[model samples]
Target: MNIKSIILGVLFLFMSGQIALAQSTGTEREITELSKKKWEWMADKNADSLAELFHDKAKFVHMGGTWGKDREVDIIRSGGIHYKKAEIHEVMVEVMGETAILWNRITLLAVVGGNEVSNPFMVTEVYVKQNDTWKLGDLTFSKLLTRD
Candidate 1:
């Protein structure tokens, strides 16, 4: 190819890559904000809002055990495991088509069985888009040895 043609091709590729990057960045921001909101809702024990966000078949994996959406909502509503606060240190998000996976490194203050405690955790959240709305499909918390 001629020098001119090569430069034109390179420019086109650059523009295409930029467009893709912009789209992904937008998605990342949206998912990150939604995750932040979810944490707030959990701390506030807003089961109604959480119920709306969680998918019908959503699963929750805690350090104690795994459960489905309804049970999870009940736990929140009843203050069975009160989420007092989540101090997020870092978040990473990835989008694949209509699905997004978010990872959060956090120190969580919670009341479990009437005992207040704090722990460092790496939390994973999975979201899927259906009918133009994002629903949480999974949430899992893995305890960390150190806060980092």
Candidate 2:
């Protein structure tokens, strides 16, 4: 009711909002780390870890085709599409409520159909928080014009 009390209340609200923003940023960092782990798992062909990270309804899109979680897992498990290495140029992540979007620019070395290929791609990954844990909801890879 008083002027001093009003100003104090506003300051309190502002500080609380800042705290929430900091927490969200922390979550974004966690998702980023999880994403890096996913790339490692893919390179290692760790289907079990991938299965746990990917949501049951997750979808994957590639230059060749698009598929659901099961097919993607199978592809990685069977060496149909082996991710040999990823040279990450940059990664940016945004958190929106329970969903997070990650954008990554990288040079990917992969073995597909018995042929080894290296290409630059911009990958977008969508993650949704499920039971307080982030799970991959969708992933798409777009080929980049520049090889570097």
Candidate 3:
């Protein structure tokens, strides 16, 4: 093969790989978006939507720094947390095969304990692709303190 042909072939291969990567990234992005929607529903106090995403053995940790699915369920069920208005400002996703970790920062205007709660927080969630569907495997939230 001529030198130019070799270079052209290499460039084609590189572009093909990039296209594949971009496609993968796009798919991963969809999964991440779904996960975010679930979180939004969680804060919205739409219990069922949040429940569906959680794996049976999923680990859900709260801003209070507590762990356990049952406890998380109890908290979710008790109705203290509600996302009256929510906005996702940023989301960063890292994917490896069937697993993904998403780091997100969201602002929530909610009603908690009958008091209006405006929370700006950061969350990290792990999602696992199972049977060609993404499910929430783990979640943690940290509240951001605002200096008035």
1 versus 3: better TM-score goes to: 1
Query: What's the C-alpha lDDT at position 73 in model 2?
Result: 97
Clash count for each candidate, listed in order shown: 0, 0, 1
lDDT of each: 0.97, 0.96, 0.77
Best candidate (score: TM-score): 2
Q: What is the lDDT of residue 11 in candidate 2?
A: 100
Task: Count clashing pairs, candidate 3.
Answer: 1
lDDT of 3 at 91: 84
lDDT digits (tens) for residues 1-148 of candidate 1: 8999999999999999999999999999999999999999999999999999999999999999999999999999999999999999999999999999999999999999999999999999999999999999999999999865
How close to the true structure is residue 144 of candidate 3, measured as C-alpha lDDT? 81
Per-candidate TM-score against the hidden true structure: 0.93, 0.96, 0.78
lDDT of 3 by residue, 1-148 (tens): 8999999999999999999899779867887778768866776666776777778788866655666566666666787666576677888888888888888787877776778867788878888888988888988877888511
Query: Which of 2 and 3 is the better model by TM-score?
Result: 2
C-alpha lDDT (0 to 100) for residue 112 of candidate 1 = 97
Where is model 2 poorest over a 10-residue stretch in terms of lDDT? 23-32
lDDT of 1: 0.97
* Model 1 per-residue lDDT at 41: 98
